[model samples]
Every structure is written in structure tokens, then in C-alpha cells.
Target: MAEAKAEFEVEFVGACPLWRGFEDQLAVALGAAAALEQKAGAVAVLLGDDERIAALNKSFRGKDGPTNVLSFPGPRVDPGFLGDIALAAETIAEEANSQGKSFEHHAAHLAVHGFLHLLGYDHDEPDKAEVMEARERAILASIGIADPYA
Candidate 1:
């Protein structure tokens, strides 16, 4: 049998110059989770600096600090029209260092997390978290990354 097909377009906007080829990795990640399809719209993955992302975090999430990654599904929630995923480069790097994981690995995980959000996965509750994490683990494992929660 042939593998399922999925496509993604990723853009980095902040201080994250390390994720230039992340678009390709995202395709693999989504494909691994069986969460991809040849939809009619695009997925935007934006990466930027702490200040810019912090402002976004505060404005949208009601938090007053920079976060590692934030998903902006846009006003519309259709997966086909999936809008953007934002990552704070400074936050990601700092978190990765503190978490003892490579910048690339953590970055990859963030991308996966953002993609799941696009697919309507949220960790707002324990049961939801379990399902979401399982999906994340499968996706990451397919790409040769260890379980993010383990």
C-alpha cells in the first residue's frame, strides 16, 4: 500500500533561523499521526523573537510573558483553512536548554503540537491531554523522536 499524502507550508518569522527546513519535517509529523490530507488551504508556521511573540501571547492568551509556542487557528476553525502556528525562538531555545533537549528536537515537537491544535486537539483537560499526547507520541515516533512526555 502507498503512504497517505499530506502537505504543509511553514514560515519562520522571529529569531528562529534554526527551523528553515521545518516545513518538510512538519509534513512528516502530520503524516505520521494520520492527521494529514490534501486539503485546499495552507498551514502557516511562524517563528519569531521573544518580544514579538510575548506581545502575541499576552494579547491572545491573556498571559504576560513569552511562551515557547502558540497556535493561532484564525477566526475560522476549519482544518482546511488552518491559519498559523507561532513559536518564540528565544523561549523555545531557553526551554530546550532547561529541558535538556536539543533545540531542533524541541522545535520539532512544538511544530507537532501546533499541528495538533490545527486538527482540533487541545490539552484543556486530562482526558483530552491523554488523547492528544498519544497522537503526538505516534507522530514524533514515526519521525524517530522519542515520546515528548516520556
Candidate 2:
């Protein structure tokens, strides 16, 4: 199989402070993944407060509230690289606090999660969860973050 030409672009659209070296780390994560065939389009990362994200959640997924991260795969997922990833600042902060992890760590984990989604990984089933999480663990380890499971 041909190596993926993964391309990444991250944007912070709200008050969330950009994590240290996050962009670089995200690029590394994209580079490490073999399944997401990267191409020309950028993978946008937007950070918003609860209200903004909640609206998006409700509109797109039919959920009633904000989520930590939402992945909107571009139309080209089947033949090439995936699309956009949106993250919520408030949710991420709350989740990191609740999970006893650093903000950077949780954000990194989410970034990996979003990227994996772009690669067609989903957690809707036990077997799928296993496969996706394993890939996440490996990629995150390469970036110096601990296994999200442990």
C-alpha cells in the first residue's frame, strides 16, 4: 500500500488557549497513521464554549448538548484523507478535570480521537472500540502521552 500523504490544519476559534506544541504533535499523529490517506484539504480544529458546541451537537448529531470533540469527515474519506474536527474548550476542560488528566493530555487524546475518526474508526461496537483505542494508544505513545486507557 502507498504511504499516506497526511495533511493537517488546526484552528482555535474561541477563547481556548492553544496547548503547548499541540499543532506539531497533531501533525505527528497524522503522520503516524497509515490508514487516513492525507491529501490537500485541511482538517480544521475549532474550539468553542459550551453553548456554541451544544448548538453544533444539537444541529448535526441531534444530541442536546456540547461534546468534547466532533469529527465531520469530508466527502473524500473513501478515496483519500479525511476532513474536519471540532473541539469544545469548556467540555475538554471539564472532562480533563473530571478524569484527573492534564489539559494538554486530554486535548492530545481528543485530537488523536478525531484523527482516528477521520480514518473511519468508530466506538459504536466493542470490537471497533478495541481496534480504535489500540491505534490511539500506539499513536499517543509516540507523542509522549500515556495510554489513555491506563
Candidate 3:
């Protein structure tokens, strides 16, 4: 049987508009990520700001502050639905600037990171983190982005 291509649906809620063509960027990122290449499903992406993401972080993960990205896995009722990934634009921009990375590259990395989480990849342990980071590096490289962990 042939593998199914993953789909992405993006919705901009707040400061996400700071970067134009974000949806296209996400499409390219997901397209280059091999993890999604053989998966049959749709991923929902919400582009928001720090405040919004912080609220989600608190409500779901019980975190106190804003994070760059958060991933919520969907139920298996519909196998075609992968899950939801939320992004904080302001937080991402700050991190990118501090880390000497382009906003686009940083955002792409976060998107891939969240997608990996949805696919059962976690970094709670050193071994697992190494594996996840390796996969992320390869995926970003395919799209001409440098190693995010470097």
C-alpha cells in the first residue's frame, strides 16, 4: 500500500501576522519533514501570540509562562486527524533573535518539533531527546535550514 501525505491547516489568531507568508513557510517545513511524509492525517496549526499561548500552556500543560510551541495529540477516533500545534509568535521571534537564527527558521523548527510530539516523539529523557533532535536536524536540513540544536 502507498503511504499517505500529511496535510496542514493553519489559522492565525494574534501576533502571528508579524511574519507574512507563515502558512507557506509551515507548508514547506512539513513538506520537508520526512516524519509526516508517510503519515496519513491532517495537522491543525494555530498561530498566536505570547498571551494566548501562555493561557493554553497554563490550561493544558499547567505551565506558568509562554513557550514557543505546544502540541496536543488528537484522539484516535479519526485516524486522519493527527492533532493540534499551537505557536507563540512573539516568543519565537525573541528566541530566534537571541539564538542568531532567522525568524522563519526558528518557526519551522518549532513546527517540526510540535509535529514530532504529535507523532509520539518526546524529549523527557536524554536518549529520547537525542533521537528527536536528530530527526529534527535531518528534517530541517532537507529544507536548507541549519542544525537548530547547534
Q: Using lDDT as the measure, which candidate wins?
A: 3
Residue-wise C-alpha lDDT for candidate 3, range 33-98, written one tens digit per residue? 634346656777888888889999999989999999999888989777778889998999999999
lDDT of 2: 0.72
lDDT of 1 by residue, 1-150 (tens): 998656544444544565566556655554554443234356666767788788988999899988887887745645565767887777888888999887777888888788778768999999999988887887788789887786
Better of 1 and 3 by TM-score: 3
Clashes of each: 5, 0, 0
- Give a tens-digit lDDT track for model 2, residues 1-150: 997654445444555454434556556655555334333445666666678779889999999989998888878534433677777777888899999998777877887798779768999999999999998898788768898889
- Tell me how far the alpha carbon of residue 107 in candidate 1 is from the true structure, in angstroms, after superposition: 0.6
Candidate 2 residue-wise lDDT at 26:
53
Q: Residue 75 CA error for candidate 3 (Å)?
A: 1.2
| lDDT preference between candidates 2 and 3, better one | 3
Off by over 4 Å in 3: 1-15, 34-37
**Residue-level lDDT for 17 in candidate 3:** 66
What's the TM-score of each model vs. the native? 0.80, 0.78, 0.88
Q: For model 3, where is the 10-residue window of minimal lDDT?
A: 5-14
Residue 46 alpha-carbon offset, candidate 3, angstroms: 0.3
